[model samples]
Target: MQQGPEGGSKHMYMEVSRQIGRMAAKGARVLEFRCVVSELYIALRTILIASVTSLRCRLQKRMLTKLLNALDAAAELSTTDRLDEVIHNMVEVGKSIGSNSSVEELLAQQNLLVRMLKKMNRLLEEEEACKASCALCSIEFLERIARYVPSSTVPIWKHMKASIINFLAWSDSRVSEHACWLVTTIIDGDWVKQWSENSLEKKKFWKNFFALLQADSLQAQRLLEEMFTFPGSVTLLFSVTDDFNVESTVAKHLCCAIRHKQLNNSNLFPLVSYFSEMVCVLKDNSENESFLCTLRRLVKAFCLATSDDQSPYFSVRNNFALTIGAVDLLRQIDELAKSGIEIYKRKRDFDNGINGGNVNPASGLKQCLVRLIANLTCEHHGNCDLARKLGAVPILLESTKLDCCNLFMTQWAIFALRSMMKEDSGCRDIISSMKPTSDVRLD
Candidate 1:
């Protein structure tokens, strides 16, 4: 905060404060955020009060219904251009009331959280009151509360359950995404204790959970399946880790389901699309690293199952050969590598990842694909021949070029190419046919 020994730099101090605030709200940091609720509330309230200029209003509650209407309209009272800042400040303190009762105690014993929940519940029940974006935000926000507060919000959560169920099957996965998370949190918190006597009623929650996992949307399915893999979205989702109960492994189940669907050869894309999305947004951080690590493991598991002759899934490879070959995964890899090259040409440079220059974003994807192809070709002479016939040799040779954006390209590409050529007869012929650099024509 002391800028060049000035010792009183408002800008420097404000910058530090903003960073600290962001850090507090990030991922698992929310667990400790309540510790500063009182301090934050004091500072935020002071700013809110100071920002107002003779904007005064008095509330005379004549009836219960009118008071509710007023509270609903009160949201619109803050027409300030800084409305987002004001709402954020309110939520920062209000949501904290779950972890820190001091926030409520400091404000004349008012339960603003309950009021907000009531409004959100109303918004969910009335189609006219909520937009898709508003509904999605509300669902996610409440999921955060359920995570921090746990069983304490079960009553409110149950009240909202009917409305939440309607969201589960909706075509838009964004809304159902957090609704599933909220349900998972409730389950973790043991919200079913009250309904333990009713077998049918208690099982309905799980019925809904399964329904979401098999939702038509692949994204919805991943978002929900990863919960069993990663649990809570508030904290656990951000802090991706391999430390989880494997008995609930949904990725394998989903893949197995795909195998069954492959009986009719339906929806054979597997998780490639999801992997593609992850690669597109992949970053250099522990969170993304752990997530991609798990993803690669899942893909490797599937590849291993199908490639091993003794394994039951070995036959699935034969059954879906036409479907799989038609996918042309190798060609997709070539296109992806080419896209990375184009991106590198446009940027003209590579940027450092979270831990300096130690990490590369697209390299994991390349490595994952290489491992997949390598595993698939091992001991499968037919697959190797197929790969060779599909122009794999030239692709791998091109990949050996210096591609700075995707680190270790040559090593990974060669590993797969070696696996391919070891079982195929034409790789040596292809390598020998290429002319040396000196003899090559520049034109």
Candidate 2:
């Protein structure tokens, strides 16, 4: 009985030792046994595939073999959909290989994670043929990975970023939209503490991200629209310029984002500066009326943001001071008003006799001006001497001399002066100065 037990135990130990020897001979490191097995499986696959191809040569063979190994390891974990497990394995392998130094181990770990994530992305893209469902699934997985980023996961951030960015590049419009939605979630999430720790890195990421957006305006627009709904979305909106060939949807989305309080402050400089430039463009004589309408909507949003009681302009010394500070902005408004007046004049000159057949463009422009003035005044009048500081009173006077001037110009003038009179005494004086006087020149 004793002999039988010893013989059976010896045979089992011999079999186990032989299996270990075979694994070692195959260059499988015990610490990275899974990776080695995956690599070996992939190598066999590549060699089998190449044997059927017309291509030849040891160099090509070696390169493909290496690629296959990396690809196989990446595919194995990705196919299993066990991202955490793969991450743990990669960490263990890195630690074992670079055990002599912490820095080396960290670098090794980071490199492996990035490579694995990238390869896995490639595998999924290839296998799913970039279909919508596959892209959605992959994005969900990527988000899961993103959650690990601030911990031991920080090493994987680079890889995670690249994978998502690449997905944006590789997918079709619908798929790209999905990918962008995923990224915006991560960007707007609490992960800021993880990445924002390094100022230089933050700057670098911003620069690169900006460049990427610049390269594809449509994608940028889509991405930006998604970002707008995010908690810090307004910051991204202010960073974009009108010059980006941005889509109308993106512009509208940005408008919505800054409608909130926290967002307005975070994006004040860029938002105001960009909006100023946009106003100038919109007021130009050359712009079509349709564009004007669109611009009006944008202006409405700006007015909304700036008109709040707690607005940045709230502490101004006088009403017109805010207008004066936005002089260039007001200039654009003036140009738009002038354009409307000109249009009215042309219509009046071309039409036959009718009392209001020659109804003034100036009248329409006056409505816009009134709306603008009222909104601004409402926001700043408590602390600002608006009528005197911005010289709006004089402007109102000049706008009222309708009898001597062409009917359209005169109408706008009257409308403007009338609006000023409604505002304050300063406006009343400006209006009275333009009364029909014999000395006044009538061309």
Candidate 3:
């Protein structure tokens, strides 16, 4: 048959993919285990390469059917080593397909995904050494599927949640980590928003999700510990707590409390306690950049949480803030500011050869601290008073005049000054003294 260049390329790819599939199928039929595994790996690799080269070129329906048949045949093999090899190969292929395939294309091959999930579930039910390997691959494959076809695959994930959670309690950290990702992805991804349309269902899902988060399993706690070390993790936690639109409920409530001139939400105490624990850890390991990153995220999350005080739930927001211990947060911020200033000064002295100490300047951390202070005190008289009492006003004023201060730092310093001046004349006096000739209006 005559063909154009595009048609010729498609024909060539289909023929090659079929040939590879045939070779794999033949090897499996003849009980040549090694050959079957090798051919399957090669076939999947070839498909992956082709997909990457041409995203529009999907697996031909015939080729996909052959591959699925090969997977089914391999799953029936009684040998553990063979099963593990097959499952591992399946994982690679699934990952490649998930990454390259469009949502519509993935939906068309839903049967393939379902079969893989069923096979993995069967293996997990068998109390064998290979279960962990099988479970890991399956969890990862499912996660990939969710990422690619989130809307269509939501039901499959919801059905598999219990099993996935079981893997969270597995002794292996890697297994637990994958399970954590799967759970979080299912809840925090775009699909959850669509799935939770019914208010009752949304309430039930959140309640159950929180229960899962608060599970007593050691593995669960390990996941939380791992997440706590990262910055955006708090925002993720907050998304599940209140509305997905706001990053952190605790942060939002704290901001609301400041605005309403009240701090009394009992429900927020646990979050405050959690922050306090994080602060203690931060103090013990101030040199760790990861901890600093977490702090930066935490600060930003709080800023976002408090940014929206105009919500209809203003009274509830105030209650949340009231319980969150303003004094405790102020102390944490003060300590962070002091440490940041020390680092900033050390870097300055070293640069000028005035001190022999070598320090890595953490400008980002300092900026986060200043931004957080500004957010906390922005329109809240109570926070302004608390900040001044904690000596934040002087620190903020100093930050504005420092040679190292960037535009961001200057802007936040100006914000903090504005807030502090709202209820304290001393803050206005300090600013006026700093710039006597300039027209500095505290009002």
Candidate 4:
């Protein structure tokens, strides 16, 4: 084993050469052997590269070190939503890494790491073990790997987006919110520049992007509210109502109505304005098909929540009014019947909000009367004032719809209509003189 003059293992080269010859002599060209050979070559290559003193190696080392630092910071940062910065840094470092690794290789590594970390985090979460540690590890891992490819990698972006989105759907609302926040920050990055140059187009893209998040948060609104806190996050919370993906339920209905009421009472109405503009954008015909659907759902939820609202804040009340400017939104269940949408459902869930028992017979019956008036007049008039001023119509209509049946809801809708309609002479006259056109046929 004569050593080479390069202060290297000269005998090692001889041994390697002899082994290759022996393998060749034995016709060891099987697929398994080839794979082993390939791996060996890669290991040798890495070792050689590490041993060399080159600018590229120096740069690679620096990027790797920076990425590791970012991971560490992500795990330890006490500040809020700081994962954005860590992920951003990781992206820069990942780009440098990608200069060496193929796009496919980088994507593969990123995906593997994300999968592993998610599994680990879930286990930790389930065991009620070191929640903070699990969160830190997961965030750091994602932040580091998320940077391997830019958003311009559409295929990779789709995968990464789904990975993050799945996290948003997690049972732990805090995890989901953090995941959503990460997604928003990443999409806001320069990678979207490839999608469009015009700033308006860019903004529109974000509107749709955020729309996805809006829908997701609504599914777990209460938990989401507790876990994540961003500057305009409150607006995002209400915006979820616009998401059609969320199935309307008694629970969600209550949540939306109650949350808005609470927000208004707490003097957080300025944040409501943040949603007003997006709601308008969502109303745009040119927006994506999904966006339009989401917008419709959001408006429906907003309508349901505000219908029974009694917020005294001028600004909060103004937002409620602004949301109505969209013609389509203004038409649902009629503006006049603000309290009408939930009459039927309300009868069922009244106990949840009221005295832990169903609404008392008197109030319950009045609610039913109110609903009838709101439904018919509001649908026809497109005016909340009609319902407000001539509330008498609601009682009469409920009596008729209920067919003298003892059903409380029917009576409530009618009474509500009469009470709201009586306030305005114009409404009273309209109600009195109104004839049921063919369009008004009883359903």
Candidate 5:
């Protein structure tokens, strides 16, 4: 006898629910709680994967509600072993629901999120380190939901930010790790876009956020290290749009922090490391204009961080040279210049009504490359000699002539040329023999 679809689903639901119920009961036994929680997690995973449509149906909804109720009931029981299991299961359930449910569904069950947060707060208050860490795990999973349902979750997250920030400095590495993930999710998610629509609101949020990081050096270092795991975090943090004004604020504060000797090499090294990766990536993918733009902003931030006289790493010249070798940077700059020249030719051909190619001119990227070269060579003798040796003199000269319409590029190209020529008479002779016309102003 073949079972109908509804009957099959009902059978599956009943079996899963019974298993979940059995596990929930077992959880009350201290010696068996860990195994029970693991079994309960498996049961929930089966329900989640069986069929999302079926899981949203009445029977499955009832089963889920039953499971949540069981977890909550177990949470109230204070046995040392059982409490941790209960908390871990609660986190697993929250993660499953968040990953599967719609925003409306998540909003409807806001009480679940609140309960988890309150549990976290209470455990933290009691100084129950293990239990509090489990609660933070639950909060991290809830934050996954918040990333999608920001409109519904932002208000709650704002209320929870203090607790989240406090946990960022927790002595337990796991608790601190979860807290970092939660805070980064909130900041980099859509909610900040909504909250910072007003200029004043944007300024206030960034000011408070950076001030919080500044208040705790170890936490700040941990957060920075966490952010470095993702490639675009630096760019996102420094990006400016009409709705956000934090780029300048972050740059200023970073410079101040460095100058005041408030931050150490450990705090600043991640930025340098990430910057090195970006430079190499940009060299290979010069056609990616968006990535190039982000690279430029990040490079600008690096320049600012290192430009300070009082910076702990006061040997900015040697530090940058060692981190991003002068030879490698010059070679990359040469590749960028070649690409820029091709773009310039294509653009010039298009202007003359010639269908030379379909590529858009990368004048902006060329300018950024030259500007970065100038920043690197400004007072760095090694970079200056490397630029002269890597045949950068010709590239800088070519860049100055390629886009007369783009005074920005022209200005940077000229600055880079001046920097390269400052101590190298051969580079000076090369520029002099080129005899750039009066129209090609070096100033």
Candidate 6:
């Protein structure tokens, strides 16, 4: 295959590749196919890495894929997740293979799997066209190693982490989503967390994660609902709350709070309050809408894990945050009306430090809080119901009347309420039945 600068060789290469895949899938001599493919890859590693010919790079990709199918067949791929799917797939493989294959044989295959994943991870950087497939398959291979493998702890996946910022922006949703899961596997790994040498690797993963979350991985929006539930991840994002990279990360963390196990309300309080004090941290580039789209998932997992939460959103001591947004906005509205526009304008600025611009008084704070609530509750009727149950409906209704210094307070309220109606009929009924004032009811 490497000798091909020849014409029409492309079609032959593709056909041979397809046949190999078919054979591998059928388990027809898969072990021998894996061995031959491994030899071919080793022979052409230099060219494949250089991608001397785009066609050759593609052929190499197919070869790697064929290799993956063989491994999965050897290990079985259908079941991975409660160990979270992929890992569970591996745990089951480890269990079943113990019955069928000798310990030495499985260990040998495991070593080879790690080497392949590392090689593919490196090749992924150079192979854009097949980057997604390369990454997806590589991650699966690594997950197959049972938790005890020392190689599993190494941050061999580190090279791929740097590429994630770009992956999150790709049009291909799987690329970004798989990238997320890859980083997640790294952080959640027992070795990565337990080892002292890899502490830097763990921190780097968190930094990358929040950075992606802050930018809002649009293509991987579905992945976010399943993201950052790992404690190490949550703590790292919190420890750096003041850092700008974490701007939108806390919101992602907060929304996932429902998935947390019996969190020490004592520990959770400081974490929640710390973010509330810096609520202005979230940036516009951060779209809080991503996870609410999976409201059913959140609601399903909602009471499944109980935490002593102070609000529908966060559990904090003194419990001031339930109406946290409400209090701030009402105070601003009163002060803006009473203190006068110029004074209020002179008093505040958004994302501003000392001697900042005379930006619109509502530009950052008002817009942020309203938009945060709206997006947080958007497609999340359980949250909307929680808000109403906590008396937020009347507050949100009162908020609608405020001009918000031309920040569209009414429009935002309408958006928030409309989003609430989108997912649940019961929440919609409760909202509709309420008459905020003689002039305006939520209907």
Best by TM-score: 2
Provide the lowest-lDDT 10-residue window in model 4: 360-369
Which regions of candidate 3 are displaced past 4 Å? Answer: 1-122, 125-270, 308-362, 402-405, 425-443
lDDT of all predictions? 0.47, 0.48, 0.53, 0.43, 0.55, 0.45
Better candidate number, 3 or 4, judged by TM-score: 3
Pairs with steric clashes in candidate 1: 262-265
lDDT of 1 by residue, 129-203 (tens): 344555565566556555554354444555456546655644456766667655655554133334333455334
Which residue pairs does candidate 5 place in steric collision? none
Measured against the true structure, the TM-scores of the candidates, in listed sequence, are 0.35, 0.50, 0.40, 0.33, 0.39, 0.39
What's the lDDT for residue 180 in model 1?
65
Clashes of 5: 0
Better of 3 and 5 by TM-score: 3
Backbone clashes, each candidate? 1, 10, 6, 48, 0, 9
Candidate 5 per-residue C-alpha lDDT over 1-443 given as tens digits, one digit per residue, 9 for 90 to 100: 89755556556666756765786776556556666456656656655655664555443345445545545554466466655665556555555564566665656556655655555454454434345645565566557655756644555564466456456546565666566566665553344344334565455444444544544544444554444334344444544232222343344345554545554454455556645665666556665645544554555545555556565554555654433443355466565445665543412322222464323434344455566677767767777776777677776776676544466666777887787788677778877887645675332
**How does model 1 score by TM-score?**
0.35
Q: Model 6, 194-298: lDDT tens per residue?
A: 422335644554555555566666423334443344334344445543453353345434545545433323344444454444333323312232321122122
RMSD (CA, Å), candidate 4 to true, equals: 19.1
**Candidate achieving higher TM-score, 2 or 5:** 2
Clash count, predicted structure 2: 10
* Candidate 3 lDDT score at position 274: 50
RMSD of every candidate to native, in Å, equals 22.0, 15.7, 17.8, 19.1, 19.2, 19.3
Give a tens-digit lDDT track for model 2, residues 180-275: 667666764354434344465454444434545655645555555555444444434344323333333345555565564324344434444455
Q: Who is ahead in lDDT, 1 or 6?
A: 1
- Candidate 2 error regions (>4 Å): 1-70, 73-111, 121-133, 151-155, 170-174, 189-248, 258-264, 278-297, 306-322, 325-369, 382-391, 394-425, 436-443
